[model samples]
Target: MSPVSPLLELDGAVQADGLDAGVAAHYGNPMIEQRRLLAGEAVVDLSNRGVLGVAGPDRLTWLNSISSQELRSLAPGQSAETLLLDPNGRIEYAMDVIDDGVETWLILEAGELPGLHTWLDKMRFTLRVQVVDHSLAYAVIGTMAVDPAAVHLAPAAPNGVALTWRDPWSSVGNGGFQYADAPAHPAADWHWTEALVLRDRLPALRDAVRAGTVSAAGTLALEALRIAAWRPRRATEVDEKTLPHELDWLRSAVHLNKGCYRGQETVAKVHNLGHPPRRLVLLHLDGSDAVLPVHGDEVEATKQLADGETERRGVGVITSSARHHELGPIALAVIKRTVPADITLHVQSQGISVAAAQEVIVPQSAGSVAEIPRLPRLGIRTPGH
Candidate 1:
């Protein structure tokens, strides 16, 4: 667990639970906070998020050789996201990366730092790269405002360039692919950014909130907006079987044409010839009951049978759900790729069944973009023979 954030001491602050336990969930009015957050007048206390720094001259090149992004040419102050995958191509870590000439900063979930730090250290070998945990020294502040100055925070600029990481989810990154066929992707408007500030600055930021110079939102408001935007978070959307293609993560965090990395073969094969077994979707849940399905809640759908009967079948599980201030109750779920896009699903939440409508993110035909032609086997015998 991370050290409790000092912002929790603010009046009307309610600490969040689960993954965001150490931070404030809301400062009394989540709906108003969400409005402030969307209007670029609020900042979120993300002290629970982890920060890692990679120093030395070889940081960029070394990182490019091991992760899924093309980071060799990452200019100073440019923001990018990368993924570390296992041998089988399952996601192990998702990092928001930014270089500041002196060091490469990696912002990720607090729980992921220790393991990612250990693995990075072992990979250094003879390279001129050194990884250091900066989570305790620097805390993350999240805001929808693209400019850090809008939030009244001067982002750290140890190397003369600010350390804010602008999310690339707003558009398909170079060498990346988009599986969502929406004419207007929700992510196109996502201007989420994270700014690193010295941990000591928290008190001053809290004071600013008290003085009304700035407003403060919480992780819940951010999560609600993230869900509405169809953003896939590493901590919630990822499972042992998750593929970048499933959540349409290839749109931002992956470079499909990049050189070999740990799971490049599987990544290529899946994109070229196979489909991810599952796909991610945004669920518009029925809000009449006022019940919200928690994570891991079963999602089922009713199917009409040939015998004129109806049957309910399990189709997926809700990974993340929230009560959006505008969108009502919304959720992101991972469902079977074969599930019909027009189907009305049911979320079993707190003993009541809530109806959900699916908005396709990763379609059933998400992969096999290459459409490579199959050839006949040379050793096959002719039917007459």
Candidate 2:
């Protein structure tokens, strides 16, 4: 009588247990199998991510004005993360932008493209940038044995591709390589080997997703790696009310010195004066057997001397949590100003205990200096003076 639920169908590559059914579910945790495949050697498909192709002469300049990161100087074939914001400085979308020089492509979280494209169109009245949706593009991600000779295999990802490079943490045991988006082929005259893998030949691999070759991952493994790499996710980090700096997005996303955009005023004021109202912290849970708190759980801090009736102090809130098989249990929580390094807190609703572990987020130092890398030379007044 009713349409079948996606969960009910349970067909190939659709194994989604331990994941939130909402669209936001993929925003926080990536699948454990995805992580395992990444750790070992396997190409994991990322078809759910959406891609946008932006081109025309003004592409870089146009993106510079809208995003938090510097885009003007990005060379062709480079990729970088950019944050799209609302007038009040709230993040509308977090995107991975790859500049192919002549054209640019943006890869965003699933279900985010339509809104972002429409917004970009509304803002592009006089700009020369042309935005087109190419959500069907395929992306395969996995670690490969690096051969220095591989540079010849693919034109060393051009300067544009260099923009997306982020050090791989788990591979930190070895000299970490970076990620880049490049065309699958080379100029025919160059006589180069293309980084192309045919889909038809990988029948066995395809069957794995159908027969479960690609296993589904849980939030646990994904959260642990995110903590290690300091990567930002939606609910776990970026929120409607959260600023770019709060997530220390400067390391990748925010270009601090960039020219004026909608929320630059607030970003500059808070950055110049002091730390933001809240900070993102990595949680090392002590009570492994205890259930991890779900997002929206109030984090209650108790004073040591307050016996039996401990005064409830609301520091901040739990943005995300996971039962990391390796780490036991862990979470990423936001805390208000000046929380004691040793303070213990509870995910108020679930009664799970999470302790502040190591602080991995990059700290904001100076306003003007921080702006230098973030701002592009757009020939316009910079955002944060």
Candidate 3:
């Protein structure tokens, strides 16, 4: 009989079937399949991101007044999405704001710390909110080992629907309900912890994933899964030039009835009356083998001409793309309304062809404000003049 293998052996049982070969090459991670499967079956660690703690007497109210979400309505232990927008209503950051009651925590992209913290500090004022950086205190997310006991776990109280226990792998940085402000519990005693993981411990988790004690995943697979889930990412989908409404942020972030905030008027106008200059659309590539186009790739929609003229100049652009075993090559693009959905667009750099599909496709009538009309050119020129 063979000696017992270490439970967290570095090279163990790995279900490597989910990752398609072409997808793996494009993503540089052949281990994505294991990660996806593990996400469904266990808990996965993703504590690399940063966490910010906001607490005080007026914390929720203060946050509600400043951000793009209805912070006041968030129940104790519930997590919600919020956006920090520039004065012109462009998205600066998109974050998950979780209310642990005593302190509402902000889980943000790792790269967003400097700008986000600065912005929050600038906004700090007469309000009693205190913002603390908790990135190094507690491990934000850790190895997801499937707990048989967690299966059939009932929804926790107070947070109600907001607190569903999944495998925990799927809920990475996803807010968990904390029973804060309960009749028996006071908000003062609560202190949220965010951990900075040591680089050395990563191997143990990876080994667990490989040995079937846990599952291993790479960034590529995680992103592909996120796309399938239709969760918008900050740096990718929501960025400097992006308006909150155009990214479907209103569904999770903005409150239609909330009082004034810095960019509220523009947000409201865009949501109520104006049509965004562009609409967000999903692209499903026909060829699975094609490398998913890189971000910022131009999408050219060619119109067939009777006179054999060349295809018209591109009217769309690709924002992001990822390889999904289930969906093959997929992307999110912003295109001019004139570009019809039936038209096949070539991803300019790779020459890969893809057709646009509606994930949450909304037309002009879908409550988005139409683009504000441009004023006539002051120095309009004519060839004759």
lDDT of every model, 2 decimals: 0.92, 0.52, 0.55
lDDT of 1 by residue, 251-281 (tens): 9999988799998888988999999999999
TM-scores of all predicted structures: 0.96, 0.68, 0.70
Q: Which regions of candidate 2 deviate over 4 angstroms? A: 1-14, 17-40, 137-220, 304-309, 349-385
Highest lDDT model number: 1
The model with the greatest TM-score is 1
lDDT (tens digit, per residue) of candidate 2 on 24-107: 123223455435533432333333445677879998888888777778887664446677777777778887666766777676
| TM-score pick, better of 1 and 2 | 1
